[model samples]
Target: MTRSAPVPAPAVREMDIDGEVTLFHEPTQTALVLNETAGDVWRLVDGERTADDIVRLLASSYGAGPDDVRGGVEAALAQLAAHHVVDLPSPG
Candidate 1:
């Protein structure tokens, strides 16, 4: 099955930890601790933006490609999701 786009920023929130790192979550608790690159992607996880938007932002911000950023984001997000750190919204 195809993965759905990430929920927009308003529906979620993020916390940046030490270094270029951050955590995404709701008001309850932190969902994940993003490493530098992953943190970059996490910072862009606004409820208003899609995963595609994050890929483009990271690519342009870090001089990378959409595929590269997308891969990293997906991997990190998967790990986070697996750990129950972040919440993927139900498709609208």
Candidate 2:
């Protein structure tokens, strides 16, 4: 079984307030309070980018290695998936 790419769920939307990006889930009536890294990840979830792409993008932005970035992104994605704020692909 292969997992597909992840993207923001339909009920979620992004907003920038005072230079910070925030993601809100309409149905859940919840807003994710994100750090800069999480905000970047939220913005990058456009239904196309893979997890590796996210790690690479953020890694380059922070001038850090991809290992830690990959772990963080994976954790964030898992949390988002648990909240149903992101659409995790079903395994085949």
Candidate 3:
């Protein structure tokens, strides 16, 4: 089964300070601070690219193999989903 691409929540507002990203979830009144790598991941969650695409892109940008950064990228996506900053689509 293939999962749909993740989408940033409509109520989530993002701010980039220097390179780090701060996300504010309006409905939950919650905030999440993302590190550089996580910020990159957040920016790419445009309801288009799948998680695997994100992993491959980041790995290539960092000069590492996809296997090397897959875990961290997946973890970041999970964390964003937990915070309601991004809505992860269910497997179909």
In candidate 2, where is summed lDDT lowest over 10 consecutive residues?
Answer: 32-41
lDDT (Cα, 0-100) at 88 in candidate 1: 62
Error of 3 at 14 (Å): 0.6
Q: Give the candidate order by descending lDDT.
A: 3, 2, 1
The sequence of per-residue lDDT tens digits that candidate 2 reaches over residues 1-92 is 55567878898877887888777889989887677777778778877888888889999998999996888898888888877788877766
In candidate 3, which residue pairs get closer than 3 Å at backbone N, Cα or C atoms, i.e. clash? none
RMSD of each: 4.6, 2.0, 1.8
Candidate 1 shows a clash count of 8
RMSD of 3: 1.8
Off by over 4 Å in 1: 1-32, 89-92
The candidate scoring highest on lDDT is 3
Task: Please list the C-alpha lDDT of all candidates, in the order they appear.
Answer: 0.62, 0.82, 0.91
Q: Which candidate has the highest TM-score of all?
A: 3
How would the candidate models be sorted by TM-score, starting from the highest?
3, 2, 1
Which tens-of-lDDT digit does each residue in 1-92 have in candidate 3? Answer: 65589999999999876767999999989889998888989988999899999999999999999999999899999999999999998877
Query: Candidate 3 — number of clashing residue pairs?
Result: 0
